[model samples]
Target: MSESFNWHKAVTKKWDQNVAFWSEKSRSMWNEGSRSGIIPFVKRYVPVGSQMADIGCGDGYGAFLLSEAGYDVTGVDISPKMIEHANQISGDRLIFKQGDLAELPFEQHTYDGLMAINSLEWTEDPKHALDELYRVLKPGGRLCIAVLGPTAGPRQNSYRRLYGEDVICNTMMPWEFEQLASETGWRTLDGYGVFKEGVKEDVSHMPKPLQQALTFLWVFMLEKQ
Candidate 1:
């Protein structure tokens, strides 16, 4: 499915209105781990002075972390509402733009690094998005992505099922992600899931029989051809 099935006005409207939900969720996960987790992970591949692009940078949370590390960061998202929130919070540290991932508005080989955390699944076409990502990145530039796993447990599965979202939603199992990277003109340097201490908070407060799906971090530090 190209997400066209669920790409009605109502869906986009709901996604836009859910900015608070996303912002709060990101704050607890990626933002909280910026210094101790994300920065260090980024430092492993992206160096100081590098120009980076963050696709689907929800509220620019991770972009802030990357900018603090001295990278010139630009955050792009499909939601203008999300971009507005990002501009308010990110200030001048990063540039936020309302744009689509599949049809990125940028020149070729313009960046030294690109980061997409948990946002890959949101793109209308993940493979095409990756192709665009590779095009805008310079040769040897790094592409870092973290996606969800297939067996993400009941908490995640239940909500997605209820919402009628894609189960293969934005997630790609380790091996599948690796294959995606290879086919997209990237050479993988590292890959794996970094599980946090617990399950998603949404499911945390839910009832029993709902096994909290352990959040798995599936990241790949890849280099462009």
Candidate 2:
């Protein structure tokens, strides 16, 4: 079944269907929701006024935030509808384009930094996606990524793969991704977890494995070597 499944097409169609609702809440998400801290995190490592790309940039609101924060931002999403909505936003330094993660539509060494919030997991091949991301960044450029944690609801996208089905979601754990990044030439600069609301624990002081186990999302700031 996996051999015959077009995971890329399916994933794009799924996001296309969700464009309306996703675009509607995208701004709130970037401003003061679960995504509020992501741009700030990228800002911490990526210098202001840098050229950056936002992968899986739904509706491009997050890209807008990056531009507002002083970066020249380009938003890329696999879904055409998402790009259409993204194009509606007016910005002198923001660009929106429809493209795939596994095969990004840009020249090599083109960006100073990149952000891929909750984006890598949905790729048909996260490794290829990561490679493409690397290909686009100048040497020593920063990359900020947010991967859904073990208990994230979005993990359900890959659950059916247990039954020999194909899925866009790759079951890549936070620690596993860290290893992959290291092997692929990314130097981890910082790492942290974003937990769900309500319960609180000082996961920061705990081991990386323990912190990742209880997070809703695991964010990493890495440098391309």
Candidate 3:
């Protein structure tokens, strides 16, 4: 992260400007084939009727899906415009709020499960963000976090090109993230990678090298211990 970078201002501006594009993209993906892998993983791991938080939930489509699956879901994002768009579609079991990931607005032990999909990679302080997530989760709460890994070269470059050097796309290595999780009182259940092209594959069972070579995103399932 750059010393002079204003993460909140920069991220907020970017998302506000692109919220319309993203809202449509999210809707299309949710309705089409993009969420096939994620939905299954969520169904298998997160029990029905659990209180869940979708951190960095842009446009709230993922939260909508989780609510449909019987989770009482709260979608949180830093972008006010994104939250506004999400609220327009909110229902009985789903709501959207504007909040920073490093300093979530909820009280302690508030959620039974949480997800941070494609979100943490842009955080200025991911460790603090993870700490906040740990603080809000009840004991044994499940967390499904997907982040951009180092291999997402094109995506990283795009951010730099569009935003400038100060706007960083911080990709984490698997081992680094695993260590952070361990230190933050989380027990890892599984770790895997998914490709950027939306291909449905079970690369979690493959070796680390092979997985890294093939995928751009890393997904981790963990339990708060």
Candidate 4:
């Protein structure tokens, strides 16, 4: 982290500028693309009608999916524009709020589960972000999270930091993120790799390490301990 850099400002600015693009693609993503599996995956552990908080919920599509799947949902994002776009869609069981991951605006033990897709890396402090997630969930609450793999193209946001530039994204690899989550008091219940279309293979028979090594993204199911 840079001492004088404004991380929150830069992150919000970046997402605000892309709200239109995100809104255009979010529906397909949650319905039939890379995120299609998340709702079902979470459903396996978090029962229907449970309260869920969707962190980094861009354009609210993922949160909509959660609501449609029968979970009462609240979607939160750092970018006001993203929240605005998310708010355009209304659901009896869903709502949107603008809030940062490191300091979510919610009471302790407020939710039964939380979902955060590609959000943790956007924070400057992964541990602190994880702690906040822990604080808001009830004991034994489920957490369904996804982190970009080592080769994911979206990780370019952190590339400029090598030359002394201040960047909002963190280059935390899948395994490293798992370790961090473990150290931060989350117990892993299950995890699997999500590869790009052409990269999918029968890696289920392989070792867990090898499976995640070839992923475009790794999704984990954890419980607050």
Best by TM-score: 4
* lDDT of candidate 1 over 93-150, digit per residue (tens): 5899987777888999999999887767665567987899889999999988876654
lDDT of 2 by residue, 52-164 (tens): 99999988888988999999999999999999988999999999999999889999999999999989988877888899999999999999998888877878988988888
Q: In model 4, what lDDT does residue 187 have?
A: 97
Q: Give candidate 4 regions above 4 Å deviation.
A: none
Compute each candidate's TM-score over C-alphas.
0.79, 0.96, 0.87, 0.96
Query: Residue 58 error for model 4, in Å?
Result: 1.1
User: Per-residue alpha-carbon lDDT of model 4 for 119-163, expressed as tens digits?
Assistant: 999998889999999999999999999999866788898898889
Per-candidate local distance difference test: 0.71, 0.88, 0.81, 0.91
Find the 10 residues in a row with the least total lDDT in model 1. Answer: 206-215
lDDT of 3 by residue, 62-131 (tens): 8898898888999999999999888888578998999988789999999999988877766778898898
Model with the higher lDDT, candidate 3 or 4 = 4
Question: Is candidate 1 or 4 superior in lDDT?
Answer: 4
TM-score of 3: 0.87
List the candidates ranked by TM-score, beginning with the highest. 4, 2, 3, 1
